[model samples]
Target: MLIYTGGTFGMVYDEDGSLAPFNFSLVIEKIPELQSLDLKLTVISFPDPVDSSNVDIEHWQAMAYIIKDHYEQYDAFVILHGTDTMAYTASALSFMFRGINKPIILTGAQIPIGATRSDARENLITALEIASTKNGKVPMLNEIAVYFNYYLLKGNRSQKIRSSNFAAFESENFPYLAESGVKIVFNESFMNTHDPQQKLEFYPKMDPNVVVLKIFPGITEEVVKSILNIKGLKGVVIESYGSGNIMSWRWMEELLRDAVSRGIFLYNVSQCMGGSVVQGRYETSKMLSDIGVISGHDITTEAALAKLMHLLGTERNVDIIKQKLNVSIRGELTVV
Candidate 1:
């Protein structure tokens, strides 16, 4: 069975007026190719499927609970999600499920499945195949993944880079785990990260009070202070410039130091889309290290924010949370 949590892939223009949600239980009828897979498939969906832009922690919990409820009945699960927040959802789920051993493939299309030029058919079919693959008498994929265009990426490592292109998602810090072509070439190096003896545990509490603060050349001190001053803010992702460089003004340093002193978890991530945060690698970023800013090594802003929310909600100690942020919990980052 599959889960279609509304996104552009499931949307269709109705004769009544605007775009209304469709029933995903009849997915096989919409794309008859699914029936040809020789698999027992079903679908469970939210009452009012939402856009990725509107996705929040509550929706994430709803999705997780749905999977938990039907964990034993389905061989594997496939999610049709909006590309915008797909990576964030994937990252959150990686943390939500502690010991996963079943495929949870998240996929969507740049065009609607009903549209004449839609790319949804191929993506959904390939995703289902990958989700159902077995190896040596057991399931092949046992981790969260994102399948789109023709690439299969580790869920936590993927980010949506394009709004209109068919290849709308990319894994910036890591390579694709598998690319579906004539054969699904599993990047054996990045596949099947499960131990048969381990048991799966679910943690669905994700706090959403984190904020991303991007540093610019002339970012004012008052602006920085105001952001850090947000009441009940559990975490802040400081998007630093260049190789994690930031303005070295005294006011900026004091504000950050004060925030850290107040026990707010501060993470430093590179503003550049492709590189890791390299605190103390240059003179400009020395203050970041001095002020105890945790480096968000090679993690995209989307993943960074999702990870913070996951950790904040699940972990209690602030210092321990900071240390775990530097570790690659589920391949979301490369810790320095």
Candidate 2:
């Protein structure tokens, strides 16, 4: 199954020369190589294409529902998404679909398919091949992943680090699952495998009452208070400095402590692209640990936020949510 969400990958030059989404019905005409793959193809597109920036909880739920409704029919699934929030979507889906026995590959392009120099054709083609590949009768990739610029990154581990470049996504803390060159090479040691007998579980609910607060030097108390005090806020993903350290400010500490007391889950994540959050490793971060702020370990801010929402939406117990936050529910973070 090929699912097309709005992105540069599906765009083409309109009659006036402006870029617009083209009909996927003619996708084979645009890229003739798909016919050579000799696989049954089915295309499902959003009713109205949406830019990635506009992606929200509703959009994520819709994607999850589509996969759940058709989980049995397809051997694998491919999602063409916008690069801007592709990592977030991938992360959310990874959590939503638990113990999935088949591959769910997400890919998009930096340029439109209509352009002569576009990278869309190769990205789409390779993503499909990887999704369909198997080890004997078992699927080669049993987890959600992002395939871009010749690298296949675990969905929850990926981050979009580049805006204008073809190599837009990276998995800083984890190794690539596979790499595409003359031939696709699988890094089986790093890739996730699942039991074929395990049934696929779909989590459709995701709470959006979460915010990402990135701490920086000289940030005022008012800014901190207003965010922590947001009405109905259930969770906050704090992007702290090196090793999850934040300035030892009395006001900030008091505010965080108060939020914890109010039952708002505080998750500490690292601001660095390539390191884990080691709360209490430094004196500054020791306050966070003392205040009951859960360490996010090596989870990306995108994945942290998505995981928070997923947990909050599904679990009613605060203690259970905190426990899940400290562990890797769907390989989104390292426990250590």
Measured against the true structure, the TM-scores of the candidates, in listed sequence, are 0.96, 0.99
Point to the candidate with the largest TM-score: 2
lDDT of each: 0.87, 0.93
TM-score of 1: 0.96
Please write out the lDDT profile of model 1 over residues 1-336, one tens digit for every residue: 688898989966688656666787778888998888898888778888899899988989988999888888887999999988998899888888877888999999888877788999999999999988887667788899999999999888888889979998988778898999998888877786657897879888888899999987788988998999999987999998978999888898899999999988898888777878888899879888888888988988877888898899889987689888888887788866
Error of 1 at 73 (Å): 2.0
Model 1: residues with Cα > 4 Å off, grouped in runs: 16-19
- Winner by lDDT: 2
**Candidate 2 weakest ten by summed lDDT:** 191-200
